[model samples]
Target: MAEALVDLLAKVRERSRGLLLRLEGRYTVVGDLHGDYATLQRVLNEWPPPYLFLGDYVDRGDKGLEVVEEVFRLLLEGKAAVLRGNHESPAMNVDGGFLDELCEKLGRGCGAVYKEFEKTFAALPLAAVVNGKVVALHGGIPLGENMRPAPLNRLATLEGDLTIPGDPLAFQILWNDPCNCDDYLPSPRGPGAWLFGREITKTFHALHNTRVVVRGHTYVSAGCATHHGGSVVTVFSSTAGPYRKTKPKIAVVSDGVEVFDLYTKSRAACPEDVDLLL
Candidate 1:
């Protein structure tokens, strides 16, 4: 409920945030919300705050405004932060219909209303370091100027405004995917999104001195999935849009990653099943 979110919208305007967040302690890694307010409420009720929301809060479903507002409210509360997802940007919003949905609600006032949302989206961090162990983000590692995996520290320099349409590190961080392949492959999601391989994840771990990467973007029917032999985990939190009827999941990061079934309300089995990029 976040106290209806209207009372907090004004507060959101007064706020500005960072590009990369360093978070400690245990927090639940919630995946792409995609406007499923019902599922978001369920996650909060079950798991509570101290959450890392891998973005895409809007688009491709109803209740986008509610989801975004609730997320903004949580950020204002100081216990949670969201990573920018590709869908959080302008192109995807226009494609995914969130802009139109927002337009219908605000009409001629759309510019002002959307600007607040846009500014908030622009300020969303691109990545988070969880307890200095696992790396959680909306997507996979970004390629450097040499078209290779960039230095881990480069994340802090990213201006994650969600409007960089080129192959910039921030854009890749929000759009890339990890795959079973041996190296990087051009993502069918199109230009900026690349499908990275096991070595990429392995090298990423070594370079960052981190153990694993937890991310969201692609949908997995089981609600949770492990790629590159458990080095990369993807969790999906919404059962709406194209992911309907599937189990929505959250990866709880504590001493280790524990996948929770939002639909079944139970701890999920370790999933080796690949998502096939569906």
Candidate 2:
């Protein structure tokens, strides 16, 4: 298992980038797991492969180690694409559940391995483009003047091992949230993160020539939410632990974006049903 993990780490370093583009085929995009292994498995079973996971695989849950191992195993098998969430970064994981989970599961000697995972996290792409029509990421794009988004190309070649006190760009990509207001505002999520409004979402799609942006960071009660007239969708797949009240969701991209509610085992057609709420 350790050897496989080491190999997976190396492969992710070489093959992964700060941004990726998917040009064809229907894809299933999942949201934050936060160490809910059972829910993760169920979602995978329901959605099948060609899956893109929107990070937060660890931390603040009891099954962090199990979830990480399973996700890595699937990744190695070419069954899924994993993006780094805020919880995957050293800044968040070092003090969150991931490190503690590692120490407890692999013993005190797990420090070196933990460092390797951090490196892997650093290499994970901040965003993905699907068929040039959608952009999927863990967090929303940064807000610029006139509610414009920072260019999608700016994140294309991002490098380096990101610590919390590290790259501001990466920090924003991993932490920002969406809002219903008309323009950008300071996020209650804290400094360095912005609560982006619908206009920003619209401008981002116009700038990138993409019609949709799929991301996960905030918790949505319906398990999924669409913003900016369906230009932005946030899907959350973790139902256990901290998200007991939230029904997990996954987004399916075929003719158009469709959100599946895992808890109710049904499809949500209206974006209003998936509104972003605290």
lDDT of each candidate versus the true structure: 0.78, 0.76
- The residue-by-residue lDDT of candidate 1 on 26-102, one tens digit each, is 88789988999999999888887798899889998888988987888788888687678888877788789888988
- What are the RMSDs of all candidates, in order? 2.8, 2.3
Once superposed on the true structure, which residue ranges of model 1 sit more than 4 Å away at CA? 1-15, 159-162, 165-167, 273-275
Worst 10 residues of 1 by lDDT: 1-10
Our tally of clashes for model 1 stands at 0
| TM-score of decoy 1 | 0.91
